[model samples]
Target chain A: MDQRKDDANWSPPRQHLEIGDSPADFNTGRVQGRRLTGPQQGFGQLWQKTYKVAIPNRTPEQIIATWKAEYGRFWPSNSRFYAPVTGIKPGEVGLIKSNQGPVPLSTGVLVLYSDDTSFSYMTPEGHPFAGFITFSAYEDEAAGTIAQVQLLIRTNDPLYEAGMIAFGSRAENKMWEHTLRSLADYLGSSAPVDTSIVRVDRKRLWKNFRNIRYNGALPWVRKVRSS
Target chain B: MPESRIAMSVRAPKDTVRVIDIAGELTAFGEGVLTEAYEDADRPGVKSVLLNFEKLDYMNSGGIGLLVTTLIRAQRKGQSLGAYGLSDHYREIFSLTRLDEAIGIYDDEASALATT
Candidate 1:
């Protein structure tokens, strides 16, 4: 077997993320010791949300290059993604600061794979969703060049599921829609972003109800511990 | 660097399980075809799905994410999921993502088909 194939396509095995020093405010031990969580480990029904925008006349490679460099700048205003100084690359961790209420929720994602046309991030424990998000650009026969963000996720815990049922899903859709719109604007296209959502699973994994213990905000610590 | 493509075919050699064989590399480009095949394979009275990855030479992160979503879709339809013929490396990939815990990983089609 050619080992280079695996080396080129997969992130090196790591139990936990090692976040380097950066000017980012949210990276202070927030991601340390947190196990990476996939959708199977989450408590809510699974969802796959795909957001795409067509940026005509540009090659997929060029779009990906710009997307990687300007990743944080394309996010919605309410959430701030603090990319590492070295920028998005395989095996790096990026901190994300978002608000649930008065408390700021600090979480991070591991750069699980990076290549010329695509990169993916795996969430750490306590993130709103447990899963991997892949960002990529590809050429569609009719669309010319399409930049897409696909999220395969489930709410991380019972509390998170409750929150999602109340508001998180809409907020998440709007957030990514804003992001695709921003990316389209950056790429000089006024095309409306396309959003497709699929409810991948309707059954909740009750076993992961205990994941609330890892809640990353001050507001949830006592609430989770008491119950 | 061979061009990536996943040729999928679904069959039912047993009453309760549907076996989907996926060959070639699975990446961003391979998802739509797989999704279509998965949806087409859905049938009443099938209690489980056995994904045969024996001919799959490569799977990137996008492919892994696609698999997770596929698993979720299967679960939603009340079908148990299992996989067979994953290379050792891909098996590790499943373990790292804890997807192996969600679905059984088997050594062969017969074993996976026999799974209860």
Candidate 2:
């Protein structure tokens, strides 16, 4: 059967991420069975960030194809994205190893949706931000093909919220900027990335303060200090 | 291809639950319609709001986020919410995202509407 015809770009369902019996890596098995967390479930104020680059001669489909194929390659080098064995199709889990200032963090994301022109990922429990980041491309009559990444996120816990206020925000901004710049460079352009941030909600959800229990930094701190 | 358009209508069915009927695709750009519909339905004395996905054919992950956001807001406002008419695919999506744990999922309209 042609899965594309039946599913129409949507992902199938899985109760939990089945990490199976893979050899131990940094944090592959941690997020294996954890549930996905969205921005609303987080404790901090909500934010929507957009990073975009204008691709002069490319079509939206072309840009999206390249973005999906080389998604991990466009990262900022220091971070690692382990694409799932089945690739970035919807419902697959991708492991991530990144840092916040001097702290090494490990987490993963679920490929929630994937289509020709766009794909979105949902962060798992214990991730710094409970959120969704969408990568997409579209034809803008004025700007040709617009390759963009949009993030709607909220700090997953009080500790992560404090980190964001310190240096995490800047580090995150640079990371995505680097990604967009790399994508533009990959497509044979050097256009400066455009970034915009919006505070979608100013009030924090104090009710979610307990989310600190899943903070990845605690385990990371313990692991690093012991070694 | 034509851009997807989202349309929503809110009406009380059986003089009980307020049903919000959603149609067309739920994408990032189409979120405003869902928001507006929820706003209109979330009035004083409305005990529960049921989202009718019968006419909703396509919804991406962003749309699921939008639904989750709306559910959070509605619950915060003390208005209980439920949904019906999701195909098995979407039902699984809800399960995968753990949205099934957050929102009540029903098989069809009759069973959903028949409930309190």
Candidate 3:
């Protein structure tokens, strides 16, 4: 859409996930938007739904297969991987087996992978894309294997900062968070991998952004604009 | 101290340049910088802009918007703009956002200065 028109309506989402160290019923003040200050001095543990994704169903093989087939389409080619095998036999036989592609791209904007690892990447312009951390389950000598994927996201829309974050007002942060949560909900527990968002230290994240350090924990973060 | 800081540095080459050290999580800060920078630039037609992203670690979609806005503005004013350093993950973000299609990126201080 046009710039002004896009910016005119729709503020950031302000919904909050059930995160807080309180009695599960404590308000903890406003959940979405900025001013998400916490544990409220003694609010217990202050938590935001930074990453709480419910992975979809299916198997790891199936999920990886789908990603290899089309996940690259939504993103650039850099997000893909390949596994190849080549060997020489005893006397005069040679065998070569190799597979390469995206690890089963999700049916939504979220990215997916089957390996027991995660990655990080950025836009050439500096915008961070939603990256993810992966967890894998293997059964019986590798015959049965399962995979879980998680994504970390933040709202990109400018209207929901709500004065919580320094950039866009809380309103923008609120809307963006809501949109992302909605996207996460839509992806649900239908795919082979489970995805979630986790809040990392912002300062640490910045350090990581500059290539000076990495937390080695959180995977990816993204900006979501309301459609 | 709101967020962890990165290692990239945006320094002044001639001491005549004015820089803005933006802090906060970029997911939302991107919009804030765009709004304020556009309003503050020398009334359209000024050159030589440097964004000290040393404090920015993670930039979401809003961060992309903020950079895009800055790039476009600079292009209009015949300015030289270059982002010197970014976290390894942010590099992928550049590719994801396709900012390479719009502006230029440098690896460190000297290159950013030389390009401009």
Considering every candidate listed, which one attains the maximal lDDT?
A: 1
lDDT order, best first, reads: 1, 2, 3
Q: How would you encode candidate 3's per-residue C-alpha lDDT over B9-108 as one tens digit per residue? A: 2334544343445554553224544556544543433456666555564554434544654554565566755565665556655643445544567676
Which candidate gets the maximum DockQ versus the true structure?
1
Q: TM-score per model for chain B alone?
A: 0.92, 0.90, 0.68
Question: Order the candidates by TM-score, highest first — what do you get?
Answer: 1, 2, 3
lDDT by residue (tens digit), candidate 2, B1-116:
12547788999875547899987777776767888898888777877889988877677766876876687677777777799998777787777666777688888878877774
| lDDT for each residue of candidate 2 in A1-227, tens digit (9 for 90 to 100) | 11123265655666455554343666664587876777767888888888999887988788888988888999987898888777788877788887546777777888888888889888877888887899988777777778889888999998889989898888889999999999999997777899999887777989889888878677776787799
Go through the candidates in order and give each one's DockQ: 0.40, 0.34, 0.02
In Å, residue A78's CA in model 2 sits off its true spot by 2.2
In order of DockQ, best first, we have: 1, 2, 3
Residue A226 lDDT (model 3) = 25
TM-score of candidate 3 on Cα atoms, chains taken together: 0.32
iRMS, all models:
4.0, 4.7, 16.9
Compared with the true structure, what per-residue lDDT tens digits does model 1 show for residues A1-227? Answer: 33236555566677676777755355566687788888888889888899999999888889889989999899877788888788887778888888734357788898888888888999878888899898888888887888889998989898778778888888888888898899889989888889999887888889888888877653665767789
Which candidate, 1 or 3, has the higher DockQ?
1
Task: Name the Cα RMSD for model 1.
Answer: 3.6
What residue runs in model 3 are displaced by over 4 Å at the alpha carbon?
A1-227, B1-18, B41-45
The candidate with the higher lDDT, 2 or 3, is 2
TM-score of each: 0.87, 0.84, 0.32
